[model samples]
Target: MTTQMIIRLDSETKTKLTKLAQAEGKNTSQVVRELIEDYIQNRDMGSYIDDLWDRLGKKLKARNVGSREIERAIYESRASKK
Candidate 1:
């Protein structure tokens, strides 16, 4: 399920990565992949849970929003401009 990826890095960075991988009993590819996956997951969902809290706060301070309110917000936020 994974394809080849070619990356270029500075000599020091490459050496560091290789050393870290060896210390961890992993290869550079595996370490980089794991790091990239974790980074991507956090970047994607890191704001989602925070947004839930923000929305819940809005609901509490003003009035608790029902499911319909959330659905409307979601729709408006993601709807195409065109």
Candidate 2:
């Protein structure tokens, strides 16, 4: 089932949107719907991204460092170079 709704835009915006829709071989509504959908999805995904970042940070902290004194080892390695 489908229902029709009306939207208002300034004339300059409408002209640009119409040309973009035509160039993409889609009607104005289809292009607008896709842009609106992407906007909504990106906004909604922010919380999920924060949770994933926390999980990744924990994993990185847990990973082993090869040498007991990492900074000293790096300075020694660098000094040995020509």
Candidate 3:
């Protein structure tokens, strides 16, 4: 589900934004939505960590690492901390 958000911007800024948006072949709303999404993604630590793990998993997989190897590594790391 999506909702509408009303924001206040100075007239000059709005004009410039509209022109820029047009040049990029997008509407003001699309540009604003992308900016908001990027801002949230950058500030959201949980999302950052999830992305990090995903990249790590892909890299490990490319090197032929398996789930069992990952589990064993985790087990050894935890055991050493005790």
Best by lDDT: 3
Write the residue-wise lDDT of candidate 3 on 9-58 in tens digits. Answer: 99999999999999999999999999999999999999999999999999
Give me the runs in candidate 1 sitting further than 4 Å from their true place.
46-82
What tens digits encode model 1's per-residue C-alpha lDDT throughout 1-82? 8799899999999999999899999999999899998887778776778878888788765875677877888898889653
Off by over 4 Å in 3: 75-82
List clashing residue pairs in candidate 1: none
For model 1, what is the error of residue 28's alpha carbon versus the real structure, in angstroms, after optimal superposition? 0.4
User: Clashes in candidate 2: how many?
Assistant: 0
Ranking by lDDT: 3, 1, 2
Tens-place lDDT digits, model 2, residues 1-82: 8678799999999999999999999999999889977887778778679878788667756785434556777688999994
Better candidate by lDDT, 2 or 3: 3
Which scores greater on TM-score, model 1 or model 2? 1
**What is the number of backbone collisions in each predicted candidate, taken in the order shown?**
0, 0, 0
Kindly report which residue pairs in candidate 2 clash with one another. none
Off by over 4 Å in 2: 46-82
**Best prediction by TM-score:** 3
Candidate 2 global lDDT: 0.82
Sequence-dependent TM-score of model 2: 0.50
lDDT of 3: 0.99
